[model samples]
Target: MLSTSARLLRLASLLQSRRHWPGAALADALDVEARTLRRDVERLRELGYPVEASSGVGGGYALGRGAALPPLMLDDDEAVALAIALRAASASVGGIEATSLQLMGKLDQLMPQRLRRRATALHAVTLSLRTGTPLVDAGLLSELATACRDGRALRFSYRKHAGETTARHVQPQRLANYGRRWYLIAWDIEREDWRSFRIDRIEGGLQLGDLFAPRPVPPDVAARLERGIAYAPFACRITLRLQGSLEELQAALPLWCGVIEPETTTHSLLRMGAETPEGLLAQVLMIDRAVEVVDADAVASDIGRILARMSSVFSRDGARVAP
Candidate 1:
């Protein structure tokens, strides 16, 4: 039999691992009788863990929200994974570096020397390549995530790309990340349409409104987010008639790359936007197939320049023999 302290730690770990545990199942896992399990649960409660219990056939135990955070026990792999994630977050996520560092310090203090070395090595080897992307407030991201999960209405001030600010009431559905930026996909209550709000552009405080009847969100929230991003206004919009299966095009392009509509079994229409025509042409070339331009006038100059460059590089007079 495990000692009292060891058994209590084991029970606590099990409770934290899942949302709920049936009384009998928990007792069996702990190798203890019902009475002993009850005592262990009571002991955990006394230690500031809000362990809730229910009665009857479907009765189970759950760890509820407590007034203060409890010390969590993590296995070796979880510890390393969390450390690496925090390190990455410190680089990519805005406004939580200090908190992440403090947590990392605590984790390092608790971890054994071997695990600590492993985490340190992983952190040293990994790099985040994001540059110039706006940082989002971590607190706002957390608030938005919680509201989305709870189906709560949110009121906040939003700044548009043209620098116009307006108050928005929305039913937040999901938080999405693309191009190293965070976005909130929500139902705009006043506009009666779906909108993607940039987290960094959300101004002031987020006022939590009453619980809302959850609306039907897109089946693929990530794909929806990508479409919204791709279709947003840009300096240049390029359309191409690609000769390939829709499935093949989707597999080759990312969600944010463009929106592909099936024209036929062997052809698809691709609409993408980029700040520069050159960039758009480059993306089209990356498709690695001959594509007919739907709007040739828009990108004719870009195509001519690219073809000229390619011709110059492969000109017969430029061929050289190795000495």
Candidate 2:
């Protein structure tokens, strides 16, 4: 026979595991009398679980929503998944690192040795490269995520790259992460077009307004966000013909590094942007393969200067050396 406290915990776990449990079946499962089961249900109610009870031939117990969050009961797989996610979030999502780490520690303490070993192995094998991206407030992320989920209109101040500030009202659609930065993809009311707002650039409080009908977002929101970051946010655009597989090109560069299209089975077209022609040229050179300039009108001079420097360095005895 289980003790009172042990029985209560088992009862709670059983209640959480299913939508409904008949009184007789529940008592049978717990190996308890009907009168004792009634007392357990009362105990759960006092603990704010909102466990609803119905009497008669079809009477049973069901856990319903309460005013406050109750203690969660997670199975082995769910516990491991949550631990891994919290660990990743600690490194990727800014402003929540400390909180995530704290939660991760608590979870690690609660997890069994088998689950803990799996979580530890995953963490040991995975590496997160920090990109020095600007920190976004966790509260702001929560607000935006809620707005996106509820189809709410959000009004917030935004800071442009040129140090200009403007007010924006948008219908929140999705929150995406690219290269360590978080972006909010939404329909800008004033601009009357889809826009990607860097979460870090959103200034002041976010005001959630009346609910709006949800709009259709891009099928591949991450790809759309990547393009917006690479081209729309920069001034100097450069297109190059890179001699490499599209998969290889994608793996070599970050998603926001550029947009790539398959030119052939072994070649790809890469379009990228930067604030300056030199900056754009440098990014093109980072690809570890032969590259042909498809369009060099903007960075011709910069490319010429770089070639000249390389020529001088490789030359010996006032003669250009060929490699």
Candidate 3:
């Protein structure tokens, strides 16, 4: 049994950790009888903590929203981890501007000098290497995140890579992050389909007419759809024998870039569909590692034409060009 002071601190910590706790479970967690737990609950109430209790199996003890915000409980590691995350999230000028920087500044003022220095050192040493075409509006991001949290449909205009535009009505299911880019997995209302939209390309997001009953999202839905898109519409499928392990190859190329499958312990097959021979050759040559182009003959004629054009350009400049 803990002393009264220790037990009271533990009780406060437990309440702050979660939204609700069943009376029995709370008693067990505190290692005390139900009566003792009740007394402790009363003590908290006397301290101005609004504790609510309900009767039945589903009933539990929960602290209501107080007149003012209460202090949070975080162990050493949790505090350090939160500080690191806040620093990184603040560095980006992205489609969604996060308020983590302002929050970080506020928290730093309250944090011990030792922890503050550690967080500052980590942030100072980190470097970012990503560059993108444009910034995503933070307002639109908040609107979409709010809709997802509230279980609502959204209307938005999406711009494709080719510059074509389309309107989408969707039941926003979940948002995911892949390679610093955000994606929304939603049930498309107009097409009666499930679709994924790149958050960076969404132009206008508006609340729609009706709310949707949420549906189950398939496990690894993003991976499956990205794989499908990699080879779906291209006219030609070319295979390459890459000289690397499956994990290394996957790191170099995203799932949407090519259909990658393992062949053995170290080797893998890359299946890519291309619109033209020129485009196919350009992609194959960019693998950046030792690889054999097994079907070079299929696109050999087009490669020759590309070579001839390159030769003419080099001759005009009188420059030595490496094939």
Candidate 4:
């Protein structure tokens, strides 16, 4: 007999494989009693799988349409994903290479020739580097993803950049992966605006809430999240104009450092932030291109103060400061 978790997973797969399942047949297939099957179905529901159940004679459970079931895939894209994911697991995690390889071979044998070619060729070129990023809980990621597919609300404590944690109520819109980190772009129910939350920084367990009506998502969710990250709140936001087009600057600089926008055919605008004006100036000085500070309001004053301080230091101890 399969373990409880494994059985539940099998049940979900069986339910998704077909629209309707007879309760007795499903129970027999799993070699579990009818009571056990019922319990497993309920467990799937709690995990955000929209498992619909019908009671009485000739009734059973069905995995509702649109449920994001990653276990038993029936779609071609999903089959490709399963192959790639197994490969990634073999490369990144320890003690599972052999197991993953065996599973990959089995899945590949079952896949149609076209899909096998696509997944294998794609996996061949991509490199998976273990960068020592924070270990995000896969179960948490799965739950949140299911919530997004179901348009469910979520409540959890989110840690800020400053390390302060606060409660958040949100209607999740989408999950965006930028670089190695995962971010949730959601409508902040408390703040009544859209906000982005880093999945790694979300504390403890999530509290799944009632389903929310779908709202108009941004035309480009990844771009919106990029802007959110680029202009994140800081003591000072530094703006710089440089002699290059946006494309040129973006290719040269790391995305985490700042955002680049077009200004003209020959110029681009850089928007970045630092905790202090001096810190901001230090970052600005690192850029290779000649930059013109473009802060037009109060931030310009702070920049001036930093400039004045630097000038005084350079004059008082030119030899010591520069050399």
RMSD of each: 4.5, 5.4, 5.0, 12.0
TM-scores of the candidates are 0.77, 0.71, 0.70, 0.57
Once fitted onto the true fold, the runs of candidate 3 whose alpha carbons sit more than 4 angstroms away are 1-10, 18-40, 43-68, 93-98, 127-134, 149-151, 228-259, 262-268, 271-323
Q: Which residue window of length 10 is worst by lDDT in model 1?
A: 314-323
Cα lDDT of model 4 by residue, 244-264, tens digit: 887888889887667788999
lDDT of every model, 2 decimals: 0.85, 0.84, 0.75, 0.80
Candidate 1 stretches with Cα past 4 Å from truth are 127-130, 143-171, 203-214, 239-256, 260-270, 286-302, 309-323
Residue range with the least summed lDDT across 10 consecutive positions in model 3: 89-98
Cα miss at 283, model 4 (Å)? 1.6
Error of 4 at 287 (Å): 1.7
- Please report, as a residue range, the 10-residue window in candidate 2 with the lowest summed lDDT: 126-135
Order by TM-score, highest first: 1, 2, 3, 4
Runs with alpha carbons beyond 4 Å of true place in candidate 2: 1-78, 117-134, 218-222, 243-248, 264-266, 313-323
In the range 1-323, model 2's lDDT, one tens digit per residue, is: 99999888899989999999999999999999999999999998888889998989888999998889877878788888898888766555667777888888888898889989988888888776755643677888999999999999999999987789999999999888776778899999989988899888998889889899978986877666777778767878878898788898888866656898789998999888888877776777776567787976867777788778878877957787776
Residue lDDT tens for model 1, 1-323: 99999999999999999999999999999999999999999999999889999999889899999999877978889999999888877555777988989999999999999999999997687675746643887878899999999999999999987689999999998888876788999999999988899898899989999999889887777766666678556667777898888898888877666888789999998888777777777777777778887865766787788777766667658663333
